[model samples]
Structure formats: structure tokens, C-alpha cells
Target: MALDRTKDSGNNSSQATGNWKPIGCEEKRAAVHVEMERVNKLPANSSYATHRLRVLNKVLHLISIQRTASQNEELELLFAGISL
Candidate 1:
């Protein structure tokens, strides 16, 4: 049944990834390809990724501020004014 599914997908999709174990050269090549793809797709100080990190940081900072604010109303207002 699963073999039929494999054959069906292979027939349909452009890239067919079935359960196949590579032995020597092919395995090494696949590993290299996967590694290269990961490296290439990884962002290096890009705007969108940085934006996401900044958002996460702001959330954590807000959480910290909220925890530490207490009844210090002036400090709470100051922190709240600095929006992300």
C-alpha cells in the first residue's frame, strides 16, 4: 500500500522523495547538497529576520519590564512609551 503511494507520488510530483538509502558517493553528494542548501537559505543580518528577532526581543523586554514594574508607575509609563 505504501509502495503504491510512493509510485503514485513519483508519478505526480516533480521532486519525488521516497524512502531510499544511499550507499557511498550518492549519500555524500546528498549530504553536501542538503548542507549547502541550509547554508544558502540561512539569513545573515537580513531585514526580515532582524525584524523578527527585534520583535522577539521586544516581547521579552516587555515581559521583563512588566515583571519588574511593580507599583513604579512613572517607570511603567516610560517603558510603555518606548514602542516597538
Candidate 2:
């Protein structure tokens, strides 16, 4: 009953066999980390995977916005001479 996550096969098709637990947020994040580590193994022009990454990035951005205030003042002071 023990699963070796370090040696996980990375075959998501196995999920349909009902042998896996429901993935929570932390597990989802870990899965993303594993996939990112193997990015070079992926084929090019995978729109589905690209879309998933974009959605994940947006979710992380929203979470950051929720957790912290904008450092607008510091940014303005640092770029005081730069014209936007």
C-alpha cells in the first residue's frame, strides 16, 4: 500500500484505474513541479499543456495579490527617472 512518489511513472493515464487518491492543492503543486523538471522531455507545440501552465500562473498571481499589498511606492522611487 505504499507508493514511491520519487519513482512515480508520470503516466497520468493510470489515474482512470481508480488506484489513485484525489489530488489536493499541495499534491497538484507537487505534480506541476515534477512536470516542470521534465519539461525538456515534452514534445513541442503542446497547446493543452501550455494553456494549463498559463492557468496555473494566473492562479499563482491571484494568490500573491491576495497575500500581499503592491510595493508601488518603492517601485516608483526606484524608477523615478524612467518614463513609462
Candidate 3:
């Protein structure tokens, strides 16, 4: 009997799910840097600046979480291959 392996192929999640590609830390950081520069150009006390700053802070927090999760996943994979 033959076995099926279509879904087992090493394609990325974007291909399996939809057209959108996953954003990595570099892209996210670049976006944050660009937004920060724009916000800095605005008046210090302006409401829009404050709002953008808040959103940027949240993005930074999420990036931190993503980095931690990726590290944890690597560690888990490493340990998973070890013998007891």
C-alpha cells in the first residue's frame, strides 16, 4: 500500500492557510522604527503622537513575546531529541 504525504510537505503556513506571509522581527522592528521617526516629527503634546506612541509600545511588547516564544520553542525541540 502507498502512503499519502501531501500535507506533510515542508511548505510554510502562508501557503497552507492563505496569501499573507508571516511578519518576522526584522520587518516589525523596521516598521516600529519608521513609525517612531514619524511620531517624533509631530508636536510633543499632540493627541495623534500620543496615540501612535501607545500603539508602538504595544507592538514592541508583542515583539518581545514573539522572541521569547521562539527561543522557548527552540529549547523544547533541542530537549525533545535528547535521551532520558
Candidate 4:
């Protein structure tokens, strides 16, 4: 199953080489943990908490789409110099 494969890949990090963590991964993860704690302390039924949850979701979405400068350069090298 797709879910099993996903879990396997996540659990088997040693199989992957190089810089597995994305740029700023630790910082972003720490920020998310802080935000989650803050969110958890908010009243469950409050509109402010709802708003914060939505904002957090958006922030996570943006972070997922973000690429590092080195990744961009690698992509350029892959495409820009190709003669085919």
C-alpha cells in the first residue's frame, strides 16, 4: 500500500544519503512545535484559535513548497547546460 511505503521510507532514513533534512528544517520544526503548544493552550472553541490554526496550515503549506538556493542551482545546472 502507498501508506506502508510512505511509512517505510520515513522509518528507513539511513537508506537515504546526503543532507536529508531540508534547509532550515530544524528551525522550522522548532517554530512549529512552539506554535502547536500555543495553539493547544488556546480555548478549543475560540475564533482566534481557529484563525491561528488556518494560518499555521498555510505556513506549513508554504514551507513544503519552498526550495533551497542550492536546490535551485542544481536544477539550473541540470537544465541550463543540457544540449539535447
User: Which numbered prediction scores highest in lDDT against the true structure?
Assistant: 3
Can you list the residue pairs that collide in candidate 2? none
RMSD of 1: 17.3
**Per-prediction TM-score, please?**
0.29, 0.33, 0.52, 0.44
Task: Say which prediction, candidate 1 or candidate 3, comes out ahead on TM-score.
Answer: 3
Error of 1 at 67 (Å): 6.5
Error of 3 at 44 (Å): 0.8
Q: Pick out the ten consecutive residues of candidate 2 with the lowest summed lDDT.
A: 75-84
lDDT of 4 by residue, 1-84 (tens): 234433445646544433354436456646765786788799999998787666665555545666678755553343233211
Over 57-80, each residue of candidate 1 has an lDDT whose tens digit, in order, gives 443454445355453444344334
Best candidate (score: TM-score): 3
TM-score of 3: 0.52
Candidate 4 Cα misplacement greater than 4 A, ranges: 1-25, 66-84
Candidate 3, backbone clash total: 0
Off by over 4 Å in 1: 1-41, 67-84
Q: TM-score-based ranking, best first?
A: 3, 4, 2, 1
